[model samples]
Target: MGQDETVSNTALEPAVPQAEASRRRLTIEVVIVLGLSLGQSAVYSILRIIERMTRNVPLSQQTSTLNQSATPDRPWLDLTYQLVNIIFPLFAVLLVLYLLQLTHPRPWRMIGFDLRRPGFDAWFGLVIAAAIGVPGLGLYLGARALGFNTQVQAAALADNWWTVPVLILAAAENAILEEVIMIGYLYTRLRQLSWRWPMIILGSALIRGSYHLYQGFGGFVGNLIMGAVFGLVYLRWKRVAPLVVAHTLLDVVSFVGYTLVAPHVSWL
Candidate 1:
C-alpha cells in the first residue's frame, strides 16, 4: 500500500479511551488524585484532631470559621473581592473538566450531568436537600451541644450590599465543586479503574468525610452520611444535577439563614 493509504487507515482506527488505556492499580490512582485535592486537609486535620483528642481538649476549642466575607469601606473593592471569592472555585471545576476531557470525548455526559432535566433535577434535588438538610441541622446542633463537634459559625460576615449575594455564590461554588468532584468525577474515574459500586461509594464517602475533618469528628460523621447518601443517589439515578442542587440549597440556607435565625434560636 502507498504511504497515504496506510496513513488513512491508521487515522480511521478506533480511539482507545483513557479508561481502558491503562491497567494500573486503583490504589495508586486514588492516592495521587486525592493527595492533590482534599487529601491535604484530610491528613492534616485528622492528625490535628487526633492530637487534640489525646489531650482531652474541648470540641469548641477546635472550630472552623466559614463564610466570613469582609466588609470593606470601599464599595468597588468589596465588590471585586466578593466576585473573586465567589468565582474562584470554578477554576477547580474547570480543572476537573479539563482532566476528564483527556479521557472522555464528551466529559459532561460521561459525568452523568443532564442540563435538559433542570426541573427534574431541581425537584429531586429539593427532595434530597430536605432529606439531608433537616437531619443535618439536628446533627449539628446536637453535636455542638454534646461537644462532639465545634460550634460552626455558618455566617460571619456582617450584612453588606454584596454579603448575601456573595454567600449565595459561595454556596453555589461549593455545591458545584464538591458534587462534580465527588459524585461525578470520582464515580467516572473509579469506574474506569473497574472498581465495584459499593467499594467506589464507600471510598467516595470516606474522602468526603475526611475533607471535613477540620470541622471535628461530628463534621466527619455528618459529611460521611451525606457522601454515602449522595453516592447511593448517583448509583440509582445516574444523575448529578440533583446532588449539585441539593448541596447548593443546603449551603445557602445554612450560611444565610443561620444569621437571621441564630438570634431567635437560643441553641444555635
Candidate 2:
C-alpha cells in the first residue's frame, strides 16, 4: 500500500508544476492589466487637478492684472504632460509583463502582435475598414447637418509642417492606449468571467464613449458610434493592429479636417 501511494505522488509531480506555471502566468497578466489601468486613471485625475488650478489664472492683463501672467514655458509643459500621460501607462504594462517573464516570444505571437504573416486577412481588414468608414463618414455629415459643432479650435497649430508629425503621434498614442485597455485587457478579463460577446462589446462601447463625455454631446455620440464600430471590428478580426491603424486614420482625418475645413464651411 505504501509503495502504491508513493507511485501516485510521483505521477502528480509533473502536473503540479504545469498547474503552478499556468497560475503564475495568469496572475501576472491580471496584475499588469489592473496596475496599468489604475496608474493611468490616477495620473488623469492628477492632470485634471492641475488643469483646474491653472485655469484659475487669467490669461491677459485685462482680465485680472494680479492673476495675469504668461506661462512662458507652456509649450514644454504641455509636451511633458502629454508624454507622461501617454508613455507611463504603456511602460507600466510592459514592466510588469517583463518582470513576470510572460513576455516571451510565444506570448507575443499568441497575442497576434507578430507581423510576419501577410495573409488574406490583411486585405479583408482593409475591406472591413472601408465598409465601416463609409457609414462613419455619413454619420459625421449627418451630425454636421444637424448643426453640430464641427468647428476646430486648433487650426493655427497645423499651419506649421511640424504639427503633422505631432498629430500623427497623438493619434497613434490614442489608438494604442485605447485598444490595449479596451480590447486586449478588458475583453480577455470579461471572457474569463464567462461574459457573452454582446455584453462584452456593449460594455466596452459604453466605457469607451463615457471617457469622451467631457468633450460634449456631439463628441459623446461620435465616440460612441466610433466605439461600437471598433468593437465590432475587434470582434470580427481579433487582431488589434488593424483596429489601431483604422482608428489612427479616422482620428487623423477628423482632426486635420476639422482644423482646416470645418471653420471655412459656409453651412457649418
Candidate 3:
C-alpha cells in the first residue's frame, strides 16, 4: 500500500509542472494584453486632446463648416474632413497597437473581427437596438416636447453626393475603433481578472458612456443605453463583427433619416 501511494504521488508530480507552465503562459499573455491596452488608451487620450485643440472650433461650428465644404465642387475638403474626423483616429489606434507589438498580423483575429456569424443574435441585436432606440427616441421627443433644449440644430449636409460615402466610412471607423477598444481589449482583460460577466458588461458600458460626456446629456444617456446593449451582445457572442454591423446600421439609419429626411427633427 505504501509503494502504491509512492507511485501515485510520483505520477501527480508531472501534472503539477504542466499546470504551472500553463499558468505562467496565461499570466504572460495577460500581462502583454494589459500593457498594450493601457498604452493604446493613453495614446488615444492624448491624440484626442490634440485633435480637439487643432480643430480649434466648437462642434456646432465645425459641423456647419463641414456642411458648407461638402459641396460637389469641394469633394476634397469633404473627403479630408471624413479622413480627419473618422479615419485618422482609427488608424492612429491601430498604428499604436502595431507599434506596441500587440496586434496580430491577421488583423481580423487580432481585433476579434469576425463577420461569418451573423446568426439569430445579430438580428436579435437589431431588435434590441430598436427596442432601446424607440423608447429613447420617444424620450428625446418628450424632452423636446417638454421644452428641454436637447436638439442639435445642424443643417442637412446630405444633399452633397459625397456625404453618403463619408458618413459610411465614419460609421465603419466608429464600429472598428470603439469595439476594438471597449469590447475586444477591455472585456478580454476584465475577464482575466475573474470578473463576473455582469460586472464586466456594466463597467464597459459606464466607461463607454462616460466618454460621450461632451456630446450632451441626451447623447450621454443614449450612448449609455447603447453601450450596455452592445456590451451584453459582446458578452453573449464574444464576436465583434455583428455588433459592428449593428452599430453601423444604426448610425446609417440615424444619418439618413435624421439628417437627410428630417433635418429639423426636435431631437437628433
Please rank every candidate by TM-score, starting with the best: 1, 3, 2
| Candidate 2, run of 10 with poorest lDDT | 60-69
TM-score of each: 0.83, 0.61, 0.63
Question: How high a TM-score does candidate 1 get?
Answer: 0.83
Over 1-268, each residue of candidate 2 has an lDDT whose tens digit, in order, gives: 6855566556666555765676566656665565557435434534543443356432121110110112324655545554555576576445433533443444334434347544643565466567666676666456545544242232234244344555666666776677766766566656655679889788777667655433323444666777777777767767666766667676666556555675677532
Q: Number of clashing residue pairs in every model?
A: 0, 0, 0
Best-fitting candidate, scored by TM-score: 1
Q: Model 3 over residues 158-214: C-alpha lDDT tens digits?
A: 356667776677666766777776777667656655779888788777666555433
Compared with the true structure, all predictions reach lDDT values of 0.80, 0.55, 0.59
- Candidate 1 residues lying further than 4 Å off, grouped into runs, are 1-21, 25-32, 51-57, 70-78
lDDT of 1 by residue, 111-185 (tens): 666697888899999999999998998888778877888777788776677678878888988899888878888
Q: CA shift at 162, candidate 1, in angstroms? A: 0.9
Model 1: clashing residue pairs?
none
Task: Give candidate 3 misplaced runs (Cα > 4 Å).
Answer: 1-73, 92-112, 118-125, 145-149, 153-158, 264-268
In candidate 3 the C-alpha lDDT for residue 202 amounts to: 82
